[model samples]
Target: MNKITYGRQTISQDDIDEVVKALKSAAITQGEYVPAFENALKEYTGAKYAVAVSSGTAALHTVYAALGLKENDEIITCPNTFAATSNAALYLNAKPKFADINEENFLIDENKINKLITENTKIITPVHYAGLPCNMEEINRTAKSCNIKIVEDACHALGSSYNGSKIGNCIYSDGAVFSFHPVKHITTAEGGAVLTNDEEIYKKCLLFRSHGMEKVNFKHMPDSPTYHEMQFLGYNYRMTDIQAALGISQLKKIESFVKRRLEIADIYYNAFKGSSKIKMQKRYKDRLNSHHLFSVVFESNDLRDKVYYYLKENNIFTQIHYMPVNKHPYYENLGYNYKDTPLAYDFYRRELSLPVYPLLTDDEVYFVIEKINTVLKAL
Candidate 1:
């Protein structure tokens, strides 16, 4: 029996040809293709600048470093997401505070953010969970009044829109990050980019990714002109040209990829519409969910586990989007426990992500639906 992966990359012959062509070129690491890919992303998201990095976590760290987060500064974020969302703040020695999510969509609750804010709060990092954009309009207003910087963890939101504006447009937030992992909307094997409309942020992000050094320029033609200067402490987080080549090729089909994901999500939604066995996340009419992961919430944790194992027994793989960050041992040792974020834990307990990718066929989709229904009937 062929194993059905929970999520996988959809690669074509075109993608391979692009990689081979890049390898045949002179520069495979830092080269022309890197900047070209960044420019492409900038235009696609309507952001003034895009800085590509090694991974999504690297992108998040670059943004925090650009913001100058320090030990005394504090940042607020939701707990119902990947640890990278909060761990980035910790990298700066800045405190990571939790703001519980809304039960409906598992997104950061705008109303609850203010109460968590304090004098030390320097940043507000909002994660657009499951490719569904957060209420940026309200979140922006809150950040402005408090004089806190806004950084969106939009790792799952490529090609998604809120109120007719792209997620990385920087309309509501100061900046946003996108991940191009194999399982994301598009893949560059392992890459990410930071999008921003602010010029200062763009320069800082660039410098932070490349050893805090900038190439110095001289008008006079010297015999050998290779000059560079180190500005501040930074990291080697630069994305390679080979990965950027794949990124440019994959980007061309992003709209079609997201469209297919949405079509799959809709099928699952209609299939489980009025059942007491499971509940789907509510998609706001104004927001277009990119459908990075089509997760369903069971009535109880026990039922969620039963369905998960039953599907696994039949060679179908499923996963949980996340466990509450506060529940992790690292966070727990720091005094963050289940009691700290009630709603996040409740949401985590019922979570069950289904298989939804561009390459997932209708036959496979129907098989999943049938197996799920069978489990529900048996229970």
Candidate 2:
């Protein structure tokens, strides 16, 4: 059998054809495909507005900027996420105060949030870790009481649902972000989007996605077609029309992709149910995970390392979802302590992501489960 990866894109011929059409169009950078893709995302996720960007990081940066995150302001978030979650705050010169995770679900423990709140706290950025929605209703309440804005770092949770609403619906957030990286639920090669119900936030995000320039609400000229104004500092974060076309095509298959991922997750759950050494993430009755990753914690860090290498030796490539963000050397240089969130640090040591993409066949899924069980039992 061929080597299996932790996750990968499942590109069909339809996706390729759409990309080809986009390339053949007159404007590849600024074209109709971009808006069409954004509209498609809006329809899928039920967001009133969507802004497509170059990558997930761009989505985070743009949304944070649009929400008025500024120097020295504090944003509370989880440490058990990709660096981009915290890094975006750093980009704005805003401090990121991390809350610990609920080890049961690998999500930000909403209970820890209020304790971290300070006068400087301006935004609460909850990361939907491993596609599992955080306790948003509680988090939203906390933020509302503090008069803080909520922006969901939902890069791992495109198809996930919370309280019977889609993850990107912005029901509990000022805006929610999604990534379209190749390994994500859908692929635009490298793209992302911000979804929001707030019109002002939506307008600001649109500006931030393209250098903070606007043609309509001009400060200088009124009706000049050649006149545009740079309202604020922004970045060249716009997604290409080609990527948008691919995103449009991929969006159509998202439900099927998420379904397959859940099926694989169930298979893994059943296979490891009786294992004494494996601990799976907890599922909540109100949350539906997109299954972007199928991660498990082992009895010990040593056992996790052994299994990771064993799988690699058997031509099955697994991955560590992340090291606690505060544990990174750069974050350490900034005096951020990993031990501040003990659960997150501990989670980092034992977590391993198995193959869980849509294209992974049932046979491949079983092969992975069989190998993992064999190694765990032998160890």
Candidate 3:
């Protein structure tokens, strides 16, 4: 039997040709492809500015740094997310607070957010879990009332929309971040980007991604005529030309990729419709998701584990999207207790991610559904 993988990159020869062209170009690291990619991303997401970086974590760190989070300042985000979501704050010596997510949507609830706010809360970083857009209108209103910055951790929602606006527009937030990992809606081998309409934040991200070096045209610099200066400490978070060349190609196919994933998701949605063993993540009627991961919440943790192992035994690969960050050893030591985010902890116990991607076939979808049903029946 052929082993079916959970998620894999769908790369074409066109992607390779672009990377090859970049490899042969003179300025492979600092070339037209990088700017071209940034422009393409800017146009797609309707953001005025974007800064491409090496990885999603790097993008998160850059945006948080741009927001100027410091010690004694705090950032609030949901526990139902990858560790990188919270690690971005811990990187800045700022407190990473956990807010529980809504069980229905698996997103950080706006009402829960309002209750968690304190004078030290400097930022609200919300992850669009499973590509479902959070209630941005409410979240925005709440954040504004508290006078805190909003940074959208939109790693799973590149092509998603909320209330007719794209996810990265910064209309509801000060900044938005995206990832282009292999399993994501798009891929650049390994890359990410930060988007913002705020000029100061945009400039800060640009400088921070490239070691904070400001190349001065002798005409612009009177004090130092011959060399550039490191204005501030930064990281080498710049994405390579090879990555950008591939990204430019990948970006062109994003619409089609998203469309196909939506189709596959519909098939899975119908397959599991009215299923007694699990419940689907709720989608808001007004929002359009990219369907990055078609996740389901089993009735119980033990049933979820049985289904997971059964699927694996049948040569089908499956995965869990996350474990609540508060439960992790590192965060526990940071004084975060599980009682802090009960809803998120509850949701985390039952969630499982099945195979979902542009290349997932109908037959495979059926096999996945049939196998899951069979496993549940035995349990």
* Top lDDT prediction, candidate number: 2
Q: Residue-wise lDDT of candidate 1 within 181-260, one digit each (tens)?
A: 99999899999999999999999999999999877543444466576667789999999999999999999999999999
List TM-score per model, in order: 0.97, 0.98, 0.97
Provide the lowest-lDDT 10-residue window in model 2: 215-224
lDDT of 2 at 346: 92
Pitting candidate 1 against candidate 2, the one with the higher lDDT is 2
Please estimate how well model 2 matches the true structure, expressed as its whole-model Cα lDDT. 0.93
Q: Which regions of candidate 1 deviate over 4 angstroms? A: 217-224
Computed on alpha carbons, the lDDT of every model, listed in order, comes to 0.91, 0.93, 0.89
Which candidate leads in TM-score?
2
For candidate 1, list the clashing residue pairs, or say none: none
Worst 10 residues of 3 by lDDT: 217-226
The lowest-lDDT stretch of 10 consecutive residues in candidate 1 is 216-225
lDDT of 2 by residue, 1-379 (tens): 7999999999989999999999999999899999999999999999999999999999999999999999999999989999998899999999999999988888899999999999999999999888999899999999999899999999999999999999999999999999999889999989999999999999999999888898786887666688888988878999999999999999999999999999999999998986789999998889999989998999999999989998899899999977999999999999999999999989989999999999899999999988888887785
Which pairs clash inside model 2?
none
